[model samples]
Target chain A: MIFSSALIETAVNEFARMPGIGKKTALRLVLHLLKQEPAQVQQFSEAIARMRQQIRFCKLCHNVSDEEICSICASHSRNKTLVCVVENIRDVMAIENTQQYNGVYHVLGGIISPIDGIGPDQLNIHSLVERVQQQEISEVIMALSPTIEGDTTIYYLSKKLQGVPGNPVKITTIARGIAFGGELEYADEMTLARSITNRLPLENYMQK
Target chain B: MIFSSALIETAVNEFARMPGIGKKTALRLVLHLLKQEPAQVQQFSEAIARMRQQIRFCKLCHNVSDEEICSICASHSRNKTLVCVVENIRDVMAIENTQQYNGVYHVLGGIISPIDGIGPDQLNIHSLVERVQQQEISEVIMALSPTIEGDTTIYYLSKKLQGVPGNPVKITTIARGIAFGGELEYADEMTLARSITNRLPLENYMQK
Candidate 1:
């Protein structure tokens, strides 16, 4: 859309650079920022810049951190031997928010999407394989999304882990299909079929 | 959502403050930025800050501009004596994009709404009335949204303008009802009924 001012146009263009935001939405966001208090606007700008500038990735887990190693990697209470592998930091946050798994995470940065020109070489796969060999990791859980690329990454990682030469590390994937509290009838055909095949024993459910 | 880093959390919170953006969407946006190159992210942040710090409003029309007076107001070819009243700078851009009107614009900043605690004094209505008296303005076209507040603001401004001494400038509102390509069946009852009542003469339609 046409803006009366060049400054507004520039700001809007910057906002539209994001994945989902369009020109109209960008304009709305810029105008919203304009209405904010000057100090608040300053804080908004500085927060983004500071985060981009000062942000560090954990040397061990490859997760975002303020220090060399992230809190999850540093913490002794978490299960260091059972690392959950995810697509990105947001997935790490999602699993963390659930508070179900007390294990640490290994962020792959992204999946193996050949369509996007992202190969396994471009990911943190080498470091993951190294960590599996170096550390006495009992199990490596694949918590990536239920997509083709996710499956491919998991397959690639399992093969790599097997070739580590010493102790065999058990690699497993997160359960897929119908989500908790989801209606059986409302589920898609593939999910319903998968959930049925992957159903647990009735006694196992009672024990849990 | 739970974030391992406070910096990511802070940036996400700031993004969530924008209209229509939720915490999840904000997190997505922040993560997308984190994936970008440092220089591009720096440009994005600096653009917003600079725009907020240095952006100026037109002295004559209150439209967003980098100059003392807006480009439209400063243009010699445009009709300076005729002004189109609008709710905000976006509306000015919308009208200008059409290239149908040659007159200058007077931005009201916002429409008057008691529900939002916004009154006539909160808008730029006074300057518009003053402009009509000061300049050789022959007509003022009300181009606000077809809302209750827009109509209220128009009524308020007309009375306020009439209170001005000397030459009486004619006041008119942009035609409202069905759009040019809009279907009568799809239109709401109020708009469809209004369009039927305000039907122009056959000769006027043919001439136009």
Candidate 2:
């Protein structure tokens, strides 16, 4: 980790500040940049800076967007009545990549993690409740990760969504079970229990 | 790989351009940046760009430096006559970290590799030869990687240095043998063979 130049040291420190990147890996990244053309390096830096400075959140769902509202929120082809709630913007992309869901999304920004000091207030929960109350949303699907925090957020949101008198917005969570190609023997006890509890009909499993 | 924002897409692409970083990892890094404050993100971007633009290579040895001459080359305490020739600036740092040698260095920038379209001409071989000829250098230690390309570069550089009449610069290479703590049984055939061929004196081995 002994840097020959101050500039390289500074750059390596900046890279090391990121999650999962250590000092050695940061140095490798900086050295790689040294091999690239100045123009290319300049472009890379500009792109990162611009992304952080100019990137906007959707006014409707809190998803990342270039405009006031995200594309999914603005799209007419998607089912606006059925909203898929996720933990972050990355989850939105993951679900979108599946191309199976035709519903709009609401990004929670993060889950309710008490240990991490992140609670329901810090997330985009208020906006989501308001969004459901303002719009005639028929169903709200919780697509958060299968974790304790996810369950807590879903429970909190479900209670809030139902609290709105006469607005019986149907609440549902994404199915939890073993992965498609995963070995049954390797499955954790919790997952095995959930898989058995939520066992699908033979015909439905065959169709999938 | 679908991005919701153009800014995020550009930033992710920039990160993906780095060696060993894939599209998913790039997205993860970009999302981590998005979580940071604007000023912090701007500082990170600026540091990388500034390093690439402002960093200088030592005119004497081609190691990365802030000034025309690197610290090691400029230091009077280091032996000017004993030069350790390495493949790149990272090698110089690695050797420096050991704190074993008190000699200066000459960075080759790269090794001779035909498949990679790299040759002696592409490296700093000419400058290294000229340096040996002009200076009162007594010894030149080849501290390059133990690869075919490294051996080729060493062979080429040795020929060029000796070609200079009356210079008589004693040329040596870093030892190629089993690592100090490596198990004898697991040592590769090439390394074990080299260790046998260059068997050191008992006293010399004990002293080390």
* Interface RMSD, one decimal, each candidate: 0.9, 0.8
Q: How many clashes does the backbone of model 1 have?
A: 0
Which candidate has the top score in TM-score?
2
lDDT by residue for model 2 (A58-84), tens: 999899999998888888898899999
User: Could you list the CA RMSD of all candidates, in the order they appear?
Assistant: 2.4, 2.1
Q: Give the DockQ-based CAPRI class for model 1.
A: medium
Off by over 4 Å in 2: A188-203
Candidate 2 contains a number of clashing pairs equal to 0
Computed on alpha carbons, the lDDT of every model, listed in order, comes to: 0.90, 0.91
Stretches of candidate 1 exceeding 4 Å from the true structure: A113-116, A185-199, B186-197, B202-208
Residue pairs clashing in model 1 are: none
- Distance from true position, residue B133, model 2, in Å? 2.0
For model 2, residues B58-110, the per-residue Cα lDDT tens digits are 99999999999998889989999999999888899899999898999999888
